[model samples]
Target: MSVTKALEGAVGWLTLNRPDKLNSMTRDMVETMAAALKAWRDDAAVRVVVLTGTGRAFCAGADLKAGNGAAAPQPGEKDSLDVIVDFFDTLRNFPKPVIVAVNGLALAGGMEVVLSCDIVLAAESARLGDAHSNFGVFPGGGGAALLPRKVPDNVARYLLFTGDSLTAAEMKTYGLVNEVLPDAELTDRARALAEKLAGKSPLVLARMKRVAANACDKTTADAIRHELLELRDHKRSYDIQEGLRAFAEKRKPEFKGY
Candidate 1:
C-alpha cells in the first residue's frame, strides 16, 4: 500500500508508505488519501486527522516517473494532475482539524500539502521548499498561489524561485510551521496535539473550521458577518447547550457532535 491509514482514539492517521521513493505521491496514493478524507469527514468517531510519511522524507513530491506522470486526461478521464488537485481540495475542505507532521523533506507537491493543512508540526531536521522551478515543473497543487498567502511574498518568492529548502526552524519563524521538535519526538508530539484537539466539541470545531476558512477569502466586515451567522445557527445546537450546562455544573461536557 502506498498509503496506510489507522484510526486511533479520535484521530485518523494517514501515512505515506513509500519511503524508498521519499514517499513521493503517485495517482493511487492521491486517490487513496482523498477517499480516506471523504470517509473521515462525516465520521463522528474521528475528531482530528494527522498526516505524515515513513522513513527519511515526508514526501519529495509527485513521482515524475510514475505511470500517471502529469499526462493530460483523455476525453472524460481524469489525469494525475486532476487527482492531485482533488486530493488537496479534499484536505483543505476537511471539516475537522488536519495536522501535518513533517518528518523530513517536503518539496514541490509535498509543500503544497503542507499549505492545505490546518496545523503543521515538523521535526527539527525537516526541510521544506518548492522545487518545481528546479525541474521546470510548475506546481499543479497550489504551491505558487497558496504559499504567498501563508508567508510573506518575499519569503514565498525566494522558496519558489530558488528551489532551496529551509530548515524546519526557519519555516517556523516564517509562521508556516506551528512547532518544531526533535526527530524522535515528532510522532509523539503530533499525536499529543491531535489528541488535545480531539477533546474539544467536534461540532464546535467543525463550525470554527468552516468560519475560519471562509474568513480567509472574505473582507473583514463580511467575515465578521459570516461568523455571526454561523454563531446564530450554532446557538441552537445541542453541543452548545451541553457545553454551557457542563460549565454551570463544573463538569466535563460530553459532546454528541450534533
Candidate 2:
C-alpha cells in the first residue's frame, strides 16, 4: 500500500509508506488519504490526526514518473491536479487538528502538504522546498497560495523562484515549522504533542480551530463579535460546566466533548 492508516489512542496516524520512492505521492495514495480523513472526521474517539512518512523521507513530492510527469489528465482518468486540490481542501476543512511530522525531505507537492497541515514538527535534518520551478511546473496544489500566508512574501517568493531547499531550522526561522527535533526524537515529540491536545475537550478544540481560521479573514470588530457568538454557543456544551466545577474543586477537568 502507498499509504497506511492506524490509530494510537485518540490520535489517528496516516503514514506514507513508499520508502523506495522516497515516499513520493501517487494518485492512489492521495485518494486513499482523502478517504481515510473523511472516515476519521466523524470518529469521536479520534481527537487529532498526525501525518508522517515511513523510512528516511517524509515525501519527495509527486511521483512524476507514475503518470505524465506533470499531474496532467490521462485518457478517461480524473485530473490529478483536481485530486490534490480536493485533498488539501479536506485537510483545511477538517475540524480537528492536523499535525505533520516531517521526518525528512519535503519538496514541491510534499511542501504543499505541509502547508495544508495545522502544525508541523520537523526533524532537524529534514529539508523543505518548492521545487516545481526546477521542473518547469508551478505549484498545482496549495503551495503558491498557502506558503505566502505562513512566511513573508519575499521569503516565499525566494524559495519558490529559486527552488532552494531550507533546513528544518531555517524553515522554523521562517515561522513555517512549529518545532525542530533530532531525527530520532521527531516521532515521539509529535505524539506527545498530539496526546496533550487529545486530553482537551474535543468539542472545544474543534471550536477553537474554526475561530482561529475565521478570525484571520475577519475585521477586528467583526472578529470579536463572532467570537462572542461562538462563546455563547460554547457555554451550552457540558464540558464548560464540568471545567468550571473542576477548577473550583481543584481537580483536573474531565471533558465529555459535548
Candidate 3:
C-alpha cells in the first residue's frame, strides 16, 4: 500500500507510505486517503486527524513518473486529476481538526496537502514549496488559491515563479508552519497536538471549523451573522452545559460531543 491508516485513541493518523519515492502520491493512494477520511468522518471514536509521511521525505509532489502525472485507470473513477481535485475538496471541508506533520521534503502537491491541513508541524529539516514551475508545469492542485490565502500574495507568486523551496523555519516565519520540531520528534509532537485537540469538545470543534470556513468567504457583516448563528446553535449543545457546570464545580468537563 502506498498509504497507511491507523487510529490511536480519538485521533486518526493517515500516512503516505512510499518512502523510497518520498511518498509521492499515486491515484490509488489518493483514493485510499479519500476513503479513509470519509469513513472516519462519521466514526464518533475519531475526533481528530493527523497527516504525515514516512522515511526522510514527506512527499516529493505528484508522481510524475506515474503515467506522466496522469493516474492509471481505476474502476468507477475519473482521471487522476479529477481524483486529486476531490481529495483536496475533502480536505478543505473536513470537519475535524487535522494536523500535518511534515517529516521531510514537501514539494508541489505535497505542499498543497500540508496547506490543506488545519495545523502544520514541520521537522527542522523539512523543505516546502510549489515546484511546478521548475518542471515547466503550473500548479493545478489548489496551490495557487490556497497558497495566497496562507501567505502573502507576493510571496506565493515568488514561490510559484522561482519554484524555490523553503526550510521549515522559513515557512514558520511565513505563518504557514505552526512549529518546527527536530526531525526525530516531528511525529511525536504532531501526535501530542492531535491528542490535545481530541480532548476538546468535538461538537464545538466541528462547529468552529464550519463557521470559520464559512466566514472566510463572506462579507464582514455576513461573517459576523454566521458566527453568531453558529454560537447560538453551539449554545444548545449538551457539551456547553456540561462545560459550564464543570467550570462551576471546579472539575474537568466530560464532553459528550452532542
**How high is the CA lDDT of each candidate model?**
0.93, 0.91, 0.90
Residues 1-258, candidate 3, lDDT per residue (tens digit)? 889999999999999999999998887898899989999988989999999999988998888888485646678768877888889888888999999999999999999998899999999999999998998877767888889999888989998889999999999999999999999898889888898999899999999898888877899999999889989888888999999999999998988899
Off by over 4 Å in 1: 67-74
Least well predicted 10-residue stretch by lDDT in candidate 3: 67-76
Q: Candidate 2 or 3, higher TM-score? A: 3
Task: Give the per-residue lDDT of model 2 (tens digit) for 1-258.
Answer: 889999999999999999999999988999999999998998888999999998878998999888576555678877887788888889889999999999999999899989989999999989999988998887887788889998999999998999999999999999999999999999999999999999899989888888888887899999899888889999899999999999999999998789
Strongest candidate by lDDT: 1
Candidate 3 wrong stretches, greater than 4 Å: 69-77
What TM-score would you give candidate 3 relative to the actual structure? 0.95
Q: Cα RMSD (Å) between model 3 and the true structure?
A: 1.7
Candidate 1 lowest-lDDT run of ten: 65-74
Clashing pairs in 2: none
RMSD of each: 1.4, 1.9, 1.7
Model 1, residue 36: displacement in angstroms? 0.6
